[model samples]
Target: MEIITINYPLQGLEDKGPIRPKTLAIGHFDGVHKGHQSVIRRAVDVARAEGLEAAVMTFHPHPKEVLGRGSEYTTCLTPLEDKLERFRSLRVDIVYVVTFNLTFAAVSPAAFVDEMLRPLQVKRAVVGFDFSFGAKGAGRAETLRELAGSDMKVDIIEPLMMDGDKVSSTLVREALAGGRPETAEQLLGVPFSLRGTVVKGEGRGRTIGYPTANIQLAGAYVTPRLGVYAVMAELSDGERYSGVLNVGVKPTFHDSLPMPVMEVHLFDYEGDLYGSTVRISFISFLRSEKKFASVQELIEQIGADALKARSVLSAFK
Candidate 1:
């Protein structure tokens, strides 16, 4: 599989030379939730049937994030790294990380097809039912079909529904924000997880006898409601460990800081993990964060959380 970054000026894309008219899947694909995956799968199947490369075209920095426009949302389901990994897992041949900016955003629909899609020799294009492109999302699937006509193939995948409601990134975000990990998982096709490198912390958890590995995260990632959760942590080497994680300030200790923190206490194992990248998959919510009356009470609560986590993960190994 080839992963290429295509810059502007259009003609330069040919440096790699003209490839086959690959089937292209286009979208913002913020989370690549179940619904988005439906579209991606169709594109891959079409590419396979036509015996052409399967390619995905996505933007960087998310258009809204770059434009400093729209509601400042928190977190993306699949960050850039995770998103690319997921695409590769689906056997995609190439992913063109289209740099999104004011200039690129202003390109007209016809110009986009001619310069971007046509140059890539896109024989077929697949997107969501409401997918749009070209300057403020002025182009729709219908418009793409109109512009390309029979010369280019186009398919618009309808929304995927689960249990009546449409599966979507927004719903997943809402679920996570509300501490509904189980619900979020239903829509994502897997448990919700966050990946980052372990970093040093204030030594609070350590002092309390439950040493923890802190993680630094990126993306507009949402913090699961202020509480403790049962999670499975995956190391870079693919090792997995069941752990208990707290996502909030130390309310029990009366800390007034609003900055949320993630502290994971790995069950039954301990070694130097600092600087090591890890992915923590949320399994279930344990309890809401609360203000304990004293350090003893806090310790007791943590002990209970450890017990709950143990029970939850007993069958995982």
Candidate 2:
């Protein structure tokens, strides 16, 4: 997929070249969960039927972060790079990453449709039922359709439900934050995962006979609750291993730490992983993090956690 970054005023977008008319699936698409997949798939199918290119439009830095809303309150499901990779996997033909700033945010609904959508040759637009656009979110799907007039078609996908709850990024975030990865997976149609580079640690896990790969997260992703979890770790070369992962401050070893760390002990694997990137997919929650009086007690509990993690991950295999 071709990724194009656009700022406000959208200069040279049309002058660069003329392309096929686009059927755009537009949304924040944070997690790109099952609900988002449905919307994108629909746009792809429509694009194929109408002989148009399938495109996805996403915003950057999140509007909330730029508009005086607290950045800490907004935890991203996937970073921009990961989100674009997801879009590529969905076979989108084009991706427009719009820079969200005060100037762009102030674009009127009519101007948005006339200047942006028209210049891009958009024949159809697909968005979720709750989607809103334009300054102050003054435009709705119906309003967009009206603005586009007879030249463009609008599609509003109804809410997708799973386990009696609407499948949404907010629900997925809540599940992960609450240490319910399995529930988040059900909503996402895939395991909730974290990608990070293996960094050097304090070597405490090795001293305890359970060597761990300390991970440095690449982006501002939502962190799961502090706990031990059953996980599957995939190395850079595509080899995957079942593991037990800890997300905590290592209270047993230190009084306090500035930040929580992610450490994963791969079952039956022995090799240097430092400096390599790995993806950890959370499967199930095992136990919450807690302080232990002695290192031996922590090791004993970790042994139990490993056994339970192996049992859970076996089902996945």
TM-scores for all candidates: the values are 0.95, 0.97
lDDT tens string, model 1, 64-155?
Answer: 87777756343567878888888887888889988887888888898898888987889999988888888888999889988887778899
**Model 1 reaches what TM-score against the true structure?**
0.95
Best by lDDT: 2
lDDT agreement with native, every candidate: 0.86, 0.91
Question: Looking at candidate 2, what is the lDDT of residue 57?
Answer: 90
Where does model 1 exceed 4 Å of error?
none
Model 2, TM vs. native: 0.97
Instruction: Report the Cα lDDT for residue 65, model 2.
Output: 77
RMSD of candidate 1 to the true fold? 1.5
Error of 2 at 2 (Å): 1.0
Candidate 2, 113: how far from true, in Å?
1.0
